[model samples]
Target: MLQLNGCAAGSSSLRLAKDIAENNRGARVLVACVELTIVAFRGPEEDYLHTLVGQASFGDGAGAVIVGADAGVHYPAERPLFEMVSASQTVVPGTDHVLTMRITEAGLDGHILRRELVPVAAENVERCLSDAFGQLGVGVEWNDLFWTVHPGLRAILDHIDKALRLEPGKLAASRTVLREYGNMLGATIIFVLDEQRRRMEEDGEGGEWGVMMGFGPGFTIETMVLHATSNLRKK
Candidate 1:
């Protein structure tokens, strides 16, 4: 397990790489990105254009997980939450600049709810999902834990739910995190995982499973399946 922050605009990818190098050192790291794209554009044409322009200027952020021979430390009496059985990523070309966040006079503003996002996302989600599950050599039905996806926005969550046809509470954690924290770019997934860990501790559940997914520029989507040990501390 690892922790990261993607606060700085456009530097997430590089920052993740740097963090992995400095902290995880020589451990193998898994990288994932989530990119937003348009499913459609409506409303006042000018407003839509402004939104698109804002998203286009957005920069990439990075996040990583170090996995290797290091057994590391342990938490007393707690079971592992989830094991990262597998991870994968996919890129939807020619759809770049569809979703983004930019530094504005007010602050960082995110533009992710495009009309085209739904359809475009729906078309690509299955392949990505299949790839992720396939890499792990297991089926999605095998999952017994939570899905800690990067909730780009309310509409994005709706689209994802529709695309994946998840159950009612399937994305509750992700949705709650998004509503509370907005999108924290690369750090969003970590936040969700952290929350999951917290929930498990509170519930005294052992051997929990979780999946972290995020989308970023380049119209990319990254997914990782993780298992948590009960021994993790509140941190």
Candidate 2:
């Protein structure tokens, strides 16, 4: 079983699942993400802010998706949602302390340098998206694509919105997921994806092209380009 940790885990699984499915004909990969932040909870710590933030923001959650090629042929009843086009992972330089978690004798310990998180993400995300799309030999406008950004913090989302000059409601799904479920760690992205699917199907709120972004400790970022298929919208 392939395993990963932190917020970027779900996106990383998507990338790996796509590779496995495409490489092995008829192979289906099931990617499951589960996080129990309670396990890491510590009582009465010196870093009260850290503990409080963790308690306030982190939650236990799980999400799963089946990835495969030749969807109609291999799984006739299964309707495909988003088509994974391309994916890339990038680490922001010299900002590893922005968000971090580790296993210690005291169980789990972590820190969130709240002030640095938003600014660093805002500064680097535009270039990161550009580089990712540039590698595909295409130019994409930020506003034209649907976004499923990891809701690490409301401020982070706001900074990204301002930085990218995104249109209103582009990040509604992410925000909604955060409000409803807090941060489910890596599994949070799946909730955001499902919410996006609902919006697309029910409201026709987004376009054909989309981007899924996940951020985690080490200031790690995961970007995946997605194409909405017919199943994503109602006929």
Candidate 3:
């Protein structure tokens, strides 16, 4: 059982799995995640909006994933649920003060979420994704892959959409999950993936290529590409 923190943990989980595959080929690892964001609300301080952002937009939940050098062992090699292709992460150059969740007298508390966050994130979003694709020697059209992004905020998603010029509906899954469940903090992206999995099982939709991305404190950005394999049982 490995634990990860921050809202970006969803993406980081995949990154960690990739690490295991690299060092111990054929070995497997599972990334389990959950968040009790409500616990951090109204802690030692009282900011209604921030607390509402935590309470109204976040809830408690847990999720997990198993990754390894090959999918054959779990599902037929021909069509495993997901094949992790590549991943990358970047830390904002000098914007540490922008977003923070700190440990203080009352446990954990989110500091003031700055107004510059969206603009700054918008400026860096493309470069971050481009950096990931470039590292993997893959050329990507935003419309070419299924997107599973962190549903941080409607405005943040808007800023990302406008900045990346993504196909208008590319982020629907993320937004849908947000509307249905608010933000489950670190567990949100996994819930988004679960949604994709169920969709694939029921409708054989969402194409072959998938892109997973998330942002967390320290203004860290994470990205990954997953290719779907058809399982006769579902697809």
Top lDDT: which candidate number?
Answer: 2
130 in model 3: Cα distance from truth in Å? Answer: 1.5
Preferred candidate (TM-score higher): 1 or 2: 2
Question: How much is 82 displaced in model 1, in angstroms?
Answer: 4.2
Q: How far is 216's C-alpha from truth in model 2 (Å)?
A: 0.9
Q: Please give the CA lDDT of all the candidate structures.
A: 0.55, 0.85, 0.75
Least well predicted 10-residue stretch by lDDT in candidate 2: 44-53
Worst 10 residues of 1 by lDDT: 2-11
Candidate 2 per-residue lDDT, tens place, 3-117, comes to 3357888888888999999999999999988888886676775645356667767899999999989888977898889999898888988988888877656667678888988
Model 1 misplaced stretches (Cα beyond 4 Å):
1-69, 73-82, 100-113, 142-145, 204-208, 230-235
Error of 3 at 176 (Å): 1.1
> 1 or 3: which has the higher lDDT?
3
User: Candidate 1 lDDT (Cα, whole model)?
Assistant: 0.55
lDDT per residue for candidate 1 within 1-235, as digits (tens), equals 2222222212234334434544664454455544232222233354344555544433333333443322344323323345555556566887766655455444444454468655666677667767776776765452354676766656767777777776676777777777676665565666566666666678643335556677665566666656565464334
- Order the candidates by lDDT, highest first: 2, 3, 1
Residue 166 CA displacement from its true place in model 1, Å? 1.5
The regions of model 3 sitting more than 4 angstroms off are 1-4, 41-53, 73-79, 112-114, 232-235
